[model samples]
Target: MSLVSKFATVGGATLISRIFGFGREMLMASALGVGPVADAFNLAFRFPNLFRRLFAEGAFNAAFIPLFARALEEDGEEGAKRFASEIFSTLFSVLVVLTALAMIFMPALVTTIIAPGLAVCVDDPAAGGNALSCAMRFEITVTFSRIMFPYLACMSLMAMVCGILNAYRRFFAAAAAPTLLNFILIGVISYALWIEADKATIGFLMSWGVLVAGIAQLAMVTLAMRLAGFSVALKRPRWTKGLKRLLVLAGPAALIGGITQINLFVGQAIASFKPGAVSILQYADRPYQLPLGMVGVAIGVVLLPELARSLKAGRLAEAQHTQNRSLEFALFLTVPAAVALFIIPEPIIRVIYERGAFDPSATPAVAAVLGIYALGLPAFVMMKVFSPGYFAREDTKSPMIVTLVSAGINIVLSLVLFPILAEQGIAWATTLSGWLNAVLLFLGLWRKGLWEIDGKLVKRSLLVLVSALLMGGALIAMMWELNAWLQPGDAVTTQIAAIAILVAVAMAIYFALTLLTGAADRTMVMRLVKRKRG
Candidate 1:
């Protein structure tokens, strides 16, 4: 398949997943809002999600995909299967121990690391009733953390299965697997609402829902593996050459991944100090994640294996072509979405989240954060596009070094901004860090001569930016024109209609502008599609 087709395969499934995630978040906002239980739930969920990104998806895919693809090239299916089995065995054993230790030390982890902000005021009797409530929040966070910690192990195993599927070019199963998580969460929340459960009860059920989703995700991916004719059985673990090499690369990649996640952890820790800040950031976060997941994560998944195979075959030109096009494709979709978010954040947030427990008063704060997040959206997606150039060559060290520096930037700025910007400072810090990471990744690729923009890609990128700006301007004008109808107090149907009109008009303007600017061509698209099928 062409890169576009492959991206569509993965991205299309991810779009479905993101849509369901939207539903899940909408329900969560109505149920949890920025309450005490909401804070605890976000904190508890972040603990396992931190480990999941570090050990399961990001680092694991970085180290595993290139190696697995290389093994398939060198030794065929049988060889690849053996390599996968060994890695799976070792990963399963290690995660089991890790999850156990984390669960046992959940309280210490909560107090010392994850949410030190929550613990700070929890013990002061002078702080009165609020202090006691803070203490209860800490206790609740720890309890939920322990319950959800096992998901890290489950998802780690599932990541291995996903690696197997992606190595074999089976993107649907892996990409679609995340939708199961959204399904489970939405169902659980909906059921809770049906029974008119308390907020705390809903919070507990959501953590348990995570564990259940992990299991369902694993089973779904495992079945995909079996159907693809791979029997990934647990064997006695040994340090095979492939396993050793993956571990060597994975150690640094894991740190790199953890560093990326630590940026969020730091922000959350800071946000934890301000009552509802954690949940507010989360509500703002969900909308932007739709594009990030649909474009950024999908491209990252497809690019790694494609680049790895091309480089392995000494097809440097092909690798460069794929890299440039993927970057262009990423920007083409991401830039306008970012522009739209930046331009009309409050309207979007108000439409999506300002209902039920999610008060209308919270919209301005969340919208401000969302706009800041939009500033980094393209950079965030481009990081995914660029990093594959390094991973395809099995050079995880460079990205690790760049990420460490980026992490420093995040921590320093977050500290500087938090006291000044308060909750918004955390969002600003994340945006700055994202841009820094993207720049470093781009520079690294250029210096190594692994990536080149060429004339067409550069033109297309500029075209995307200009087109997005125009669309943003047009949307602004329209929103102003429709102010009476789009006002916050309008009926739900009116709000939905306003958003739909805005999106449809924005998409039309952007795509039409791209065509007019020569950023896209129907002939080229058709040819690419034909070539992919051929």
Candidate 2:
């Protein structure tokens, strides 16, 4: 498939997943908001969710995709399938052990790393509010964490299946699988709400929903593999040559993949000290993640395998074109999203989340954090586009070192900023660290002469920025025009209409300027679409 087609396929599926994710979050806002139960749910979910992203989405794919793609290219189908099976066996064994051990020591993990402040709140009888309630919250968090930990194991295996499918050029099934999680969560949460279950009971049900979703996603992708004519069967663990090499690549990649998660860990740890900070960050984070996941994940998934294929075949120019275009595409989409979020965060937050327990008082804090996170959106998406250059060549150590430094910077900054700016400081730290990582990755790529932006790409990128700024200006003006309708006391319909108008206007202005300034590649997009349809 053409790059655009591949992106569209993955992007289309991701859009669905992101939409479902937004629905899930909207429900969460209404159901939990920023209360104690919400805090508990966020903390509990972050535990397994962190590891799942770190290993499944980050490390496993970084190491697995290039190697697996190369295997399929160089080896016959049998050889590739054999390699996949062996790697799967070893990975499953390891994840099983890790999940078991973590579950056994769930309490310690909660106290030491996940939510230290919750533990503090529980231990200090003199602390204000209900000590019993605080203790119950900690206990529920631990229970939910234990319930959700197995999801990491399932999802890591699911990611392996996805790597296999992506290498085989079967993108839709893998890309579509994540939406199942949202669907399941929405159902579980909605059902809980309909039955009027208590918050703790509802939290437990949602925790189980995570596991169910993991299982469903795994099954869906596993079936995709079989239908694609790939048999990825389990066998006794084997320490094969490919497995050893995978581990070598994965060692650094594990750290590289964990960088974002580690930053999140830092933010969550700091936020846990202040009640409701976790949920506030989570709510603020949800909207930004829509663009990030849609642009970043789609680009990352499609680009990595393509780069691996091109580089393995010694198509240096093709590899460079792929990198440049991917970067261009990311910026083209992400810049406007970042601008919009930065300019009108309050109305967006209020419209999407200011209902039920998410009162008007919560809007400003979440909006502030959302705006800060907006600054980092491009960097985060750029990292997704840039890191594949190193991974495709099996040179993970460079990105790993850069990720370690970026993570350290995030932690130190979060600590320093949390006291001064609260959760918004953590958001700033994430944004700054993302830029650090993106810059370092580019520097490494430059030093190695692996890639460079052509003059045209740079010019167009500048045009993209200019267009986005114009759109931002237009959006800000419209926001001013709709100020009364955008306020908290306005009817929900009015608030929604104001946001819809602002976004529609912003998009129209941005795209019109992009075409007029020659920032967009209309002919290329049309050709890709024609070829895809043909």
Q: What is the C-alpha RMSD of each candidate to the true structure, in Å?
A: 1.9, 1.5
In model 2, which runs have C-alpha deviations exceeding 4 angstroms?
Answer: 127-129, 525-534
Angstrom error at residue 215, model 2: 0.4
Query: How good is model 2 by TM-score?
Result: 0.97
lDDT (C-alpha, whole model) for all candidates: 0.87, 0.89
Give the TM-score (vs. native) of candidate 1.
Answer: 0.97
Tens-digit lDDT track of model 2 for 299-377: 9889989999999999999999999999999999999999999999988888888776677799899999999999999
Best candidate per lDDT, number? Answer: 2
Per-residue lDDT value at 240 in model 1: 87
Error of 1 at 523 (Å): 2.0
